[model samples]
Target chain A: MNVRIDTYQQAVSRILRFDRVQRTAHWANALLFGILMLTALLLYFPGLSGIVGRRALVVNIHVWTGIALPVPLLISLLGPWGARMRRDLRRVNKWTRDEIAWLWALGRRAPRVVDKFNPGQKLNSLFVGGSIVVMLATGIVLKWFQFFPVSWRMGATFVHDVLAFAIFVVVIGHIIFALAHPESMRSMVKGWVTEGWAARHAPAWLREETGEMEEDQSVAHSD
Target chain B: MTTTAKGAPDQKAGVTIAVGRRVFLGMTALGLAGIVFGARLESVLDSGLQRLFPWWPGFRIYSISGSYPMISEAEYRLEISGLVDRPRVFTLADLKAMPSTSFSQEFQCVTGWTVPNVEWEGVKLSDILDEAGVRQGATALSFESYDGADSESLTLYQAQLPDVIVAYRMLGAPVTTEHGGPVRLYVGPMFGYKSLKWLSAIRVVDQVIPGYWEQNGYPLNGWRDGSTGPTDLALTGGVA
Candidate 1:
């Protein structure tokens, strides 16, 4: 009877929410972006720059960090180790009508159905991906301004500044959201979430994980 | 000073004023104090901090102009005039034919970027000044770029520094147009900006005339660490 009880408890225990590859990629991206932001600030502000000193070193850190920004993501998308990440990327890109409804119904009676990522998370991922590419291009132009035309350089400067400000705001928002959702934060770090937590927060994802039909919305609320 | 003298209400004595005499005097004194000491002290303190911690953070070049004027070697000419016996022009070839000195020194920007041990080769600025035979009362020299957008001035003493040169070659190659080359001024001891780019004309002046950057709040003595006499580019307004 005790062994049967233990087996039942194990069935309801922690289930893998993020694979090791996904966790690695996410953490690596976060760290690189954090360093890039810090170094960028030191380079941009005169007062801050004076405190930090060694501007060339700061520039190198910023440039090389930006260059390596996509490396983890790209690596995570390769090989059998990346299968889960690859599927999640597709799911994140494929927005269903319920996801849109969930976003619209936010702050009201919201839909209980959420996949591995909600609409907001998907949007954030898209934005972060697009920003990394744009920022890298503009940053390269800024670093090698002499190679480009003056007009192009000026435009790149303006875009880089505006996008950096936007990224700073979004990244802050991303951290805040992560902090607000304690289970989600733990899931990213630990590569798992308890079955009960997944059932509550990501019912459709839990069903998909359990080899159940993904199409049925009738029981979207697992609770 | 000329503008101040012209604009001074000092002579307008006792005309019915809104404020009381003491209040007026106080405000005037405060304003004058802010004018003279505030800017100068801020710059002095700022550069002082830099000297103490020469480790600057960031790489950027500051330029006042949007366009660069790149005159080719054929078109490039260095005109030496004003307070000179022989106010003559030296072609690029003429400059190249003259004795050239080569040395590697740190190219330090005022805005806090340094390209260290940059190899520069060119004619000594003093040699040309000597050739021109500066008039007895000449106290300073003015440099104008072919670009028409930039100008620089140095006291006669500063202009003749052993390392100050009219550089035609840099980094083992003919100076590129982007580096302000073909002919450019290289002032070794001071900030890189004092070394104006794009060789064009040099005019000896009676007093220090602030360059474009100077007029825009840069110290007249743009030494790396306030290493030279500021001597008040402020005082030279009337003389220039």
Candidate 2:
């Protein structure tokens, strides 16, 4: 009976792992980010632009994509996922002692309690979100550079390039981590992780999801 | 003891003289420092930013004609017609005979590149217009290239700006064929497009007419000073 109950609870947890809203926003944001990265790469590298041909077309597409990037994000805010996104945003802003300890330990030791997002993931999200805002602002100024003073335009370009470099480094780091942990990728793609995988990696999070302290305690002891 | 002009003692006058000399020296030092700082600041603002980017020779050449048109100096004639009471034609020598003025200006292209402190010497467009006797109703001037491949227009006001001239020389030398020799329109505060190259003819008109690039979707009023004028170009299709 105990084993059967455990199996039933695990199935429930798997189903509730990632809802449609979160999955949609994640994929949409990723798609936009990929487009932005490719266009930026082409624009920054003159050789690449030469190879691509049709520089005007590439530039137009890049400008349009950059302008349209925030659409999905803004749309997501009006849907059922809005509250969840807000909660995640609030959660990411604060770093708990356990999170700091987990970071210091370099994942060698687990935190006493973990939420839906790990500290690193939270930081990554915050950075990417902040970067998008900055990129959008600078991009608008650059596109309408004629409207602004030369010094202001130059300053905007400087800031935009610096931020792009910083974001590029952070994105590479994010990709490396994602590749290192295939389970994380699977969770983003398939919207579910196995009970065992969750217990091993995010045991505290799994406990919170299950809402059974005694059962989680037993599982912890067994491990 | 020697007496001063004010009948003061030589000792007191000597002290006053010393103080005056010191004050004069301080002011001279400050003035020299200020001039140096001002020059440095101007240089940085002028060409330092341009140096940060790849520098191209001969004004970052862009021509719709595919190739730069070569006009022999002997055959070149600038025709001034349309809303002029006295329509006239001037040869290269005739333009050269006119009084010439030179000024240092930054050239800004509509495509977002700039060349700074280009010394252009030419007869002012206003002087030419005045010689042709511009009619009262003339509102704008249409400039055509020698090859007739491209043309640009400027409002009468824009053409009359102090820096607006029909340039035949750049950097103290005659303008090269590659850089619109013989004569090219130079509207200093406007984009390079408005400063039409390979000039051939000018026609004063009653209304603003779009030029080559302007017709192909560039701002009609390409002001480099970032002023949102009444006739500011309305960008369409992300061209500019």
Candidate 3:
């Protein structure tokens, strides 16, 4: 009754792959966004504007990175590559009978490991994506308004502050996970994974893409 | 303008070298374009969009029903009345003579943009009120701006959120005419509506009164963090 896109394994492998340009933009944006967030936090502390000295420079950097953040993000939205990445990122849940049994046995932790994205990552994507849009809008409004009334600006401040805080927390989690799972980080850095690493962490994806079952994998290993 | 500069090499030098020259020129042009665009954008960001679009209704403030300029310092007057033992009428000079308090905080607008950490300098409303002395039963104060767009009045509690102050200076400079110079109120923490410009009057009252925007169906309290809708009729109850 239901159609499945290439098995979960294929989707995972696709996501783990990135081109050199994609990786460069991804890391550049990550660094820039991190700096922008830090400057934003500095905005809260008095006298920081003096050291950064020019409010205009702070805003310039913030706006530039804001503009840049969307570039890599949008580029990742095309063709087969984008499609697979989207599938992996999607919150669509497809739990098989065995998976259901595993969930029943392991409680919350089982689904966390098997789920396409843990609830937190899904929430993080939504919040971060939403925050970027809001920040862009408010930043432009503040920057180019012929007559930005006071009330709207005030409201924007609260939203920006709150979202920035939320992003900070979520990004911390993302960093921790990337570091904790060195192999996961390695794939992103290297743009390719060996058969062994692929089989261990993404066996289902490996099997789906190669059309090899677990039994076939042992036969291949012996050969 | 010619593609080559005055001291630059002649195009006749060689085709291969000319191609390299053309590439260099192209890159320089792009770099120059980026710098120009970046600089323009920087200025645009520093001044805020309100400065760019004056005709937009949301960008301007209308007082007490939009009949006339909602705020005009020229027609403004500050009266210390109510339970005050000595009700005094202070001119702009009188208010300016008072000790001033200034600090920087984010200026938030409800429409969704913020001018971070604007330096605001003004005399504390409380300090002025204390000098005049609040008589018994003086539960609140009221503000009236030159803008008559508001159909109702704002109560003291609404006016005197801790972040509130009668501001006169911004960014360490006495406000210019364009920037609500002479004297204006800066309501901290709240959106720009709370900071009335061309502020000319302050009066002590015994009861909470809805402000101009409040009567116009804006939130009475107008707290920035409340529900994300324009529920202006809700009263913020507290004594300031």
Candidate 4:
């Protein structure tokens, strides 16, 4: 068996490619977003809105936060970080033969070391994309009730709030996976992975980009 | 490209895979549709639910800085006094003597629901202030609601929004008792809080003092559209 050490520049560029900072910022926003939605739900109970004092303050904060929620996400998108993240996440998804085999042998084999994103990632991309759209549409409707009829506005509030809880669960899953896999977190945070890690996980990527092969043992030994 | 690959596309596995893809796509489409319905549904539910149950506080068109279970217009009279060279007590009819301005705009409650485009016809608060010839150094206006439901104060500076009118008509009809009828002050451009329904008296104050709601906890000036204030005034003041 042979393996090669991919160059530091090549490995670093590939890992550093996406707007990971924007991803972090987006995740950070989920906390406040959840708080706003939940409080709005609380205000819906009978005898609550006019309970006056803290309840009313909570209600006010909920509305103000709802109005403010989209601002950070919108600003992040206009920045370079947001644009690059959009570009990288849109990478055409292809499964190599080895990955196909991994899929076939799912229960029989240990999880494969992976480069970039795995199958679950593609699904997550879809989930987050769809989630954002739903949250944005429903959220604004709830926030700006005067823009629509009362019947329609009421419905928007219901949907906006229930979906917020759903997003909360999804975000938890995402964080758990990130923690369970330190390598994934490291790549995002540091924007680089050692050559050995790449050779084991993303051999094809390493080969394609560096014109080097794991078959080159001497280079691997040097690293 | 290989014999093994050809063999792998067997009937049972291929059928399952194709069915799985169909199911996945179907689920995605359903999810997308659900989200659309969800977004629209929340608003629809809020209004439909309100229409079904109009008596709910969030849906009630008759609430302002004061108490409820209010007095009738026959018994209701508005007194304009304090620092005005002349003090006068006028029945609801006297208020009708003044020219009125009416228009419809959204009335936003702090609790996240707004009744949109409420058509109101009433005297402009400005008309009354001008008639009273507000004395200089009268920095604030105090409002007294009939039925003694609410007594609230606002700064003259804050009361000057362009759409602030002392509304009398709602939706092309005379305002009903249930809707602050006989004559309610509709501060159109201000938050529903400032629109003090069941209004009965206007007093000019020398200083900007917080009134019933403001003193309790509500913001000093509740101008909807993201007003920064406490939830609402403590509900202890007399009727509106």
Best by DockQ: 4
Candidate 3 interface RMS: 22.7
- Scored against the true structure, residue A41 in model 4 reaches a CA lDDT of 50
* Candidate 3 per-residue lDDT over residues B119-219, each given as its tens digit: 98878877777778877887766676554332234455554455577777788887644345566777675656667655656667777666664543455
Model 3, residue B26: distance off in Å is 45
* Top-scoring candidate (TM-score): 2
- Every model's TM-score on chain B: 0.70, 0.72, 0.61, 0.68
CA shift of A52, model 4, Å: 16
Tell me which of candidates 2 and 3 scores higher on DockQ: 3
What lDDT tens digits, residue by residue, belong to model 1 across residues B134-226? 999899988998767678888898887789899999988998766787899988877766888786899998888888656544567666554
| lDDT string, candidate 4, A1-223, tens digits | 1233445456454544235566565555665667765674555543433333244356567767766665666666667657545433432133434444555786355334343455456545556555555555655554544454434444454455456656667767888987997776677666566556667666534444354344346544653
- Can you give the lDDT of residue A10 in candidate 3? 52
Please say which candidate is ahead in DockQ: 1 or 4.
4
Query: i-RMS values of the candidates, in order?
Result: 27.0, 24.1, 22.7, 10.8
| DockQ-based CAPRI category assigned to the predicted complex of candidate 4 | incorrect
Cα-based TM-score, every candidate? 0.49, 0.56, 0.42, 0.42
* Candidate 1: residue A220 lDDT (0-100): 42
For candidate 3, the TM-score is: 0.42
> Model 3 off-target regions past 4 Å?
A1-22, A79-107, A112-123, A145-149, A194-200, A212-223, B1-240
